[model samples]
Target: MTYPHDPIPDLSADRAELFAAAAAEYDRYRPGVPPEAAELLAETLRDLPDPTLLDLGTSTGQVPKALLKALPSLDYIEGVDLSQQMLDQARAALTPVLGGCTLSLVQTSAELYKPLAPLPEEEWWTPDLITCCRAYHWMSGPDVLARTHRIAAPQASLAIMGDGSLWMHEADWTRALRDLVQQFLGAGRRAGALGDCPKPVRPFQEELADSAWSDVAEHRFPVTRSWSPESVLGYLRTTSFAGADLFAERHAAFEEEARALLDNLADGGPLLEETAFTVLLARRRAGAR
Candidate 1:
């Protein structure tokens, strides 16, 4: 709970577990990564005929699903997360696409993952690509990146991705939604599982600069997600801070008021929002430690 690297140390790990409590809601309502971002990820690993990928903090497998669809050449993918419930949804949703590639899920934190290595008869396998979509901030920044660099293949590329979460954006609808959440959960945005989530700075580029994955490049893609008022409410329940469990005794009241607020913000229809999805690609130097 007291991560030395965390900008705000008071944010508890219990807050991060809220997503596990609302795992179903999270699977059902969280936004998907832009398809183009997945394509760019594929391009970044173009040389590998059958790239093995690791999805860090792979919540409900949204990004993995997109990558599977766009990067047909990927042969193996491991979805790692701290919550088994979240991994269950990911496995269920990703089961349909297991035809050409092998899919595996590990209920663990990224900072501690050592790939498949260090286990007897199961040698450690290096991934050609590592993706942490909107999850890097939730991790111990430098530690995870360092582990990723260690497990990655010499030519492996780590993609640290971000497309702002719903609670952090500043659109008119988003601001109004924030106000609604504040009314129930106070002024702070609820992250569902990760407490009082603070955005992680671009730690990878800085960390990678001194590590094996030092060649850095960034690709940005514009994305717009349209959301109905009801959908917004559903999404909020999946978040750590605004989750129903967080509301405790006031959960029902919170939902009712939130629905009402969203309905008013809807202006009789869905809301359109645009945000940038960015991928910071860092490639490991050949044979470098």
Candidate 2:
């Protein structure tokens, strides 16, 4: 399918290095894909006798780890990302759980990645399932989706999913936290060194509708997450909008004030964030590829 829109000018804002400094903290604090989302992905692969997975923006291997738990029969797994630090974390976290499964972690952006040619007699390396969890917003949708269609198996499935970040949650505590971050970093949302958050792209559903993977289904799982003040702080440290690096010398002060605010807000209890984890599952019609 030819995209009607002009080629997007790579609005991801220097993402290759955006998460480099916070990768370890990101792995420690970022939540994994919800279990129901994994089950939904697993359902799509049930018919493939020996499925392989290609995970785009596979930060810390969270999505693969969740899916592996749901579908141990998967034969091969490949993770693509821009940060080597994140891939290193993903390798460490995913290696032990992948009993007998072949794993490849590549350091590259999703749009430029190409699978290695399979060995003689082996089917060409085409993933049966492609997933981009919590990271698709950092990519050029039309370019990535077009590239994905070329690399995926004839009947492959694509899942783009994420829950909004803590920065956007409506809880009173989160609002206070956002206010504190703004005080330190100014009003514009930070996108690493870029200093301004990228504008929101068209919705993923609309992007999918324009691509070859136009047969789409959406599933949303309502999740209630509990966070202590410390966990919330750790998660904040991994975000571009509020990470310590963005705060310069004022990071310590921000954390101190945030801790006090969260303590008062929690009143000796967990801070709760009620969110809906949304998954956009897409595929092409038979022979449409």
Candidate 3:
């Protein structure tokens, strides 16, 4: 497949390293793609005899692990991420659950990933389903989408899914936690070496408007998550905004304060978070390929 844009620098290095130090904590504390969202993606693959899947930004392999369990028809999967640590975690987690399915974990940014060519007499190895869960915001959207369109099968479907994290949620304890983070790390959200993570200039729907993958469907799942005071501390350590590196020598101090604050807010009960997981499923416009 030929690319229209000029060869771009490997920008995924920063995104990959953003969570490198917290890979294990992230795998342990982060939530997987909700079952309903996984089922929605699985629905798109049910008709295909042997579906191939590609997951961009497969941090710790949560999305693929869930989808593999949900869809037995899924025959092969490839997970791409720039972080070797993250890829290592993904491999360990995804291998045991693969059953008869084949798996590949590539350490590269989505924008630069090129699918391996098929063998003689075979066509290109295009994926039947493409998914980017919880990690699309860090990517080069237009470039990645264009690359995704190139390597995806003609009838393939793409799903971009994520939810607001605890830092962005609206609750008394969360609000207090954000305040505490700002007090220590300043106002803007810390995103490792990138400083503050920038929000996409436009939403995904608007971004997809002129792309080949213009046929779109939106699905939202209401999710309720509970976290204990210790769990909240663990989750914070895994996030870019409130990670331990940002706190430096004050990491333990911040954890102490955060634990106290959360404990008081929960009053010995689980801290409950009500948020929505959103999935934007897209397909190529008929006759666009």
lDDT of each residue in 79-143, candidate 1, tens digit only: 88777678888888988986688887776678766564334676567888898997777788778
Clash pairs, candidate 3, are none
* Reference-based lDDT, each prediction: 0.76, 0.86, 0.85
Off by over 4 Å in 3: 1-12, 117-123
Model 1 lDDT at residue 103: 84
TM-score of candidate 3 to 2 decimals:
0.94
Alpha-carbon runs more than 4 Å astray in model 2: 1-13, 287-289
Considering every candidate listed, which one attains the maximal lDDT? 2
List model 2 lDDT by residue over 22-65, tens digit each.
Answer: 88999889988889999999998877888899999998999889
Total backbone collisions, model 1: 16
Model 1 — TM-score against the truth? Answer: 0.87
By TM-score, is 1 or 2 better? 2
lDDT per residue as tens, model 3, 73-160: 6888888877778877888898899898988877778878887556589877889999999888887788988989887888899999
- The stretch of ten residues in a row with the least summed lDDT in candidate 2 is 1-10
For model 3 the local lDDT of residue 109 reads 82
TM-score of 2: 0.93
TM for every model, in the order presented, reads 0.87, 0.93, 0.94
Candidates 1 and 3, the one with greater lDDT: 3
